[model samples]
Target: MDLDVFVAAHQAEWARLEQLLGRGRRLTGAEADELVALYQRTATHLSLVQSSTPDPMLTGRLTQLVARARATVTGTRRSGWRDAARFFTSGFPAAVYLTRRWWIPTALISTAVGVLVGWWIATHPEIQNAIGAPEDLKAMTKPGGGYETYYSSHPAASFAAQVWTNNAQAAAICLVLGGFLGLPVLYILWQNMLNLGVGIGLMSSADRLDVFLGLILPHGLLELTAVFVAAGTGLRLGWTVIDPGHRTRRVALAEQGRAALGMAIGLAAVLFLSGLIEGFVTPSGLPTWARITIGVAAEAAFLLYVYVLGGRAARAGDVGDVERADQTATLPTAA
Candidate 1:
């Protein structure tokens, strides 16, 4: 058949098939199968038309038709805030479970284990002498320095500034390192673990473990958890590119990016707040119980927001008929 005739015929059939498909709630299995068959027939006709034609206009028309079909099959509209809220909340429990079940425990255990091992190794008289321990370690059997000196030197303002800077740096690292194709992010996590371990070890060795915990535990829990969550987000992004499963890599990455970015934003907020607590509140001689209570409350609030409040907001948004109608209207239609 001539290319023009073939194109005109396929366009009519396509329109008819679309109308049939749109007539009811959804296409039944048999209807869906028939639709698939029609699509195959369309493809075959287009292939034959292209092979038979030398005219540029015919080729261009064929190209345009294929492009439209591809878009119809793959294109998705940008989800509005309501859709975003729903997705964010719906996934909250899973996020919390993942963090508490694995991320938090892993970071805590790893740091504790490293600290224990390091303290044991460092404090051994034989090793200490062999390594020619620093004079200060021998000179001060008691942990030196008071809260006044530490707070005065590092002040709340300075501390908050430092925390904010570090949190920003960590967030950037999570986004960049996690997007890589290899184990770069894992390596980054390992380095973080090592630093945490060493700090714990040093504090323990100085017999200032309680003091250190008082200062860190108040905010470290939130700040470090945020880091892990960010890393997890990155890992998901990398996984989409590396192991896209059934979907094309590009599609997988786009979908995962949307979900992961939401989590990352939440994590960044956590880090910022944690920094504030660490710099200002943690340094004050607040009662240990009060600090612990506040820390627990913060964590609880985070959990509730991510798991409960977030989900409720999303569901409400999803059920907004007016909003969905607006969205549908704005979406591009098949030509």
Candidate 2:
């Protein structure tokens, strides 16, 4: 194929398309019709030139022109609060529900690790002693000690904000950093479980396991679930790198990565609720059963939301990704 001859043939049409696009206002009816025709032809031209010729500069220019023309023909869409409503009601939960296989096991294994560490420390006086002097340990585990006071140390509003920020950041990190093959996600899970184990070990050794449970159960249930969801979504994304199933690695990663990002936003809202419980309910005067009941109810509600609403959404084809039109168009590949 003669590249110069082809370029000459299309140059006028390309120039006209560019002028129409650059007009920066609504196109006349005839111009709109012309732009649509040009866009379709240019896209075909791009595919042909890509296959037959290897002119990077010309291809790049046509690629950009085709993109701009396509957008103009399709009409740009601007999202509003309705999109956010749909996301929260459908996209977010569907994403989380879809990844339940990953997060459920994550929650179970991580909890077991926490329990094992606690049991080891609680049974081994030497380890407990190594952690702190006997006197300091007693002071910390006493009736109104550090574990109990920590929740109420700050004003409630500020404390809730702080907890929300910290937990949300942790969840965001898990989702974002999971792209690196999940090593960082494992490390994060370990650190969190380690802390939980330390508290359990110390409290059980002090014969105040009930106190620790009372302090933790109110907020810990939901708070930990959000973290687990984020971690699982991230791990799922990392797994795409190793096994992308039917799709190309790039396509699989893009799909899962977008879902994980959406889950991050959803998890942030979940963490905020947990933060409220941690700040206000955990340390409040509610009886242990009452506080724990509230936490249990919240957790149950969240689970139901995922299964019922999310299942429906997924069945309806919402995969927690951007609308199809919003996604970048991929050129057809030979099978």
Candidate 3:
């Protein structure tokens, strides 16, 4: 494998391919055929040189030439809009639907924990006393109190933006921290449940449970669902770190991480809708039943998206990852 002899042999073919590529749209049929042939030959030369020689300059030049020729052969790719269309239609939902086994139970268990804690606090006066003075708790639960006024504390637009930002941040944390064996995600979920339980307990004890439900349900259904999705996806990622099944740990983490990131983007949009409801519909003069109906509808639609669209995409082998061409891989070590 004399580097000089190899370069001398293939240099003309590589130069011809480069010249054809530089010709752009003006290439003739014969030139196009020649270009393809030279490109293949140069590719083999690249492989040979890579295996038998350590000539960095020659390898780099051939790499660049082959890449340029490939672009000329294949033409440019599709636009960004098409990619976005594909993502929402298939990738995002598929990722969510695939994680149903993880998230559905997360939702159920989180809800159960919140309910149990709320019930206990409502029934136990001593616990309430320990939490705070009865007067303060009473004030918060009373009509036109902290629970009711919190939604209206700021202008509607500002309030919606604030809520959206806060929730999105929480969701992002749950997703990114999932790689740390899911411990942080668990803590986040527990803290969320505890806070929700305390609020429900205080409201119920004050006989303002209806008020609490009316306001919370309108936004919470979708909002909490988004959070649960994040937490669930994160846990799945952590579990992948522990047990990657048939795939290597690195591959599993990368695949699941991409899926989790897709979920994060989808969840952001969901949380935005929830924030809108919280700022406008929840605190609006709409009847309690009407507001709750809107929340229920939104939640149902999201589930349908996951199960129908997502399930279809998953079955078709969409894993919410980038296109195959965009994936990173190491060169084969063996011939």
Which candidate number has the best TM-score? 2
Q: Candidate 2 lDDT (Cα, whole model)?
A: 0.91
Q: For each candidate, C-alpha RMSD in Å?
A: 9.9, 2.4, 4.5
TM-score of each: 0.60, 0.92, 0.80
> Which residue pairs clash within candidate 3?
none
**Model 2, 160-274: lDDT tens per residue?**
9999999999999999999899889999999999999999999998899999998999899999999999999889888888997877677788888888888988999999999
TM-score, cand. 1 vs. native: 0.60
Candidate 1 lDDT, 49-86, residue by residue in tens: 54556467755654555444444444545667876664
* TM-score of candidate 2 relative to the true fold: 0.92
Residue 73 C-alpha lDDT in model 3: 73
**Per-residue error at 329 for model 3, in Å?**
3.5
Which segments of model 2 are wrong by more than 4 Å?
1-12, 45-60, 332-335
Enumerate clash totals for all models, in the order shown. 3, 0, 0
lDDT of 3 at 120: 94
Worst 10 residues of 3 by lDDT: 326-335
Each model's lDDT: 0.60, 0.91, 0.88
Give the lDDT of residue 76 in candidate 3.
67
